[model samples]
Target: MSRLLRILFLTLLLTFTACSKDDDSEDGGTPIAGNRLSTGDSARDFLSDENFDELVIEVVYVEGYRPTDAALNNLVQFIEERCHKSAGVELNVRSFPSPNIAEFNIQQVDSIEKVMRSQYNLGDKMALYVSFLDGKFEDDSDDSVVLGAAYRNTSFVIFEETLHRFSDGINEPDRFLLESTVFRHEFAHLLGLVNLGTEMQTDHLDTENGSHCNVESCLMNYRVESGINIPGMTSEENIPELDSQCLADLRANGGK
Candidate 1:
């Protein structure tokens, strides 16, 4: 064959190979419209087209801030069951326990973001991070107790303190309920419930906080005050679930 023809053939072959690789691994998930803002609607849109491969959720915790076996199992079960039933995506969850760290005051989200990005490398999969850190989350002005924080698709719960508070003089079941409620609530945010990920077909968002739903009974309500409802935490069976509006959004946004 002529040298010129050989060069042309080589170029064609390279192009074909590149296309094949992309076809195999290209993210099948839908892209978010406009700027990638960390809004409830945007997050939902990002995960709407996740027909790619597997949905991997990484649960990380400080050595001293881990949940009980029952709590952890319940968390995994809730996540796996909900994702499979609603999103039709296969779930792969892995947990990593980091060495205990003494300081727990997170001044900003970047502190936790840095740790998450460095330790857990989530390559191309549809990934979310759940970090269990010690102490309470604080800002410059206020030092109120916080259950967790979610940005984009990552969430970290300062749960050790809260768990200790709830279980201070309670039984195992009560403690499990507290942990499970917090666990599911954070996961709900990641799922874009209550007009977070995808806009609610109806108006259920609590515009006041801009992250939680207006419904009092919904799991995404922003009233997760530490000791507000201790009696409600009496049973593990009473863990929160997504309200109908959130479920509709999930279904419309490529979830089941």
Candidate 2:
């Protein structure tokens, strides 16, 4: 190649490499595409401080469907206990007018996230988005109802309207207990529980249910996130916790 052409090519290559590094560093070495990845894809980022030294939970809810303070507190406590964010964890809560939808599918929930979510991985902080909606999940049936779902690496939705319907009724669980249980259960999915991003230390995945623990008493159990099971699962004063097998998996995957 000519000398002039070769020099130009080298300069262009250097510029491109510098820009790429800047982009990667801005996102804590995660690509922009990583933000849209599937659930549990960022489990290590959430559990360990290798990439992110701080965590921010951005919670948005419909005006009339805000989660109880107790539930939100429980969620913060749950994360602090497991994840190793040395710079500390923070919660930012806000509310929006109801979207006026009675039922929501995963796609609709994702669309709402795209419009309403304001936080993303930046610098040394990893951000998570949680939404409380005034609707039931589209897949809910007469026999079973979903209380919450972790649908993306950093996004989840809680059917707060549905939770209220099921809780504090005849033979039902307390609203705070039920809300806290669903919140922790969905967050656990983001942390890669029950064979979901973090590898399991032992075989505990429920074969019939998708990405849930087989242990009935564990917070990752399938029934823990179901409205139909809340009465029975919340019969005790305390909420369910991660079983030994699930705890082992978390510890093995950079959790405390």
Candidate with maximal lDDT:
2
lDDT of 2 at 140: 69
Root-mean-square deviation of Cα positions for candidate 2 versus the true structure, in angstroms: 14.6
Per-prediction TM-score = 0.66, 0.84
* Residue 243 of model 1, lDDT score: 80
lDDT of 1 by residue, 167-219 (tens): 53533236566677777776666666656556677788878766677776677
Alpha-carbon shift of residue 3 in model 2 (angstroms): 80
Q: Quote the lDDT for 222 in model 2.
A: 69
Q: Which ten residues in a row are the worst by lDDT in model 2?
A: 5-14
Query: How does residue 131 of candidate 2 score in lDDT?
Result: 94
| Per-residue alpha-carbon lDDT of candidate 2 for residues 159-243, written as tens digits (9 for 90 to 100) | 8887887778765678888788778888888888767789998899888876788998788876554433333545435788889
Tell me model 1's lDDT, rounded to 2 decimals.
0.50
lDDT of 1 at 17: 22
lDDT to native, each model: 0.50, 0.76
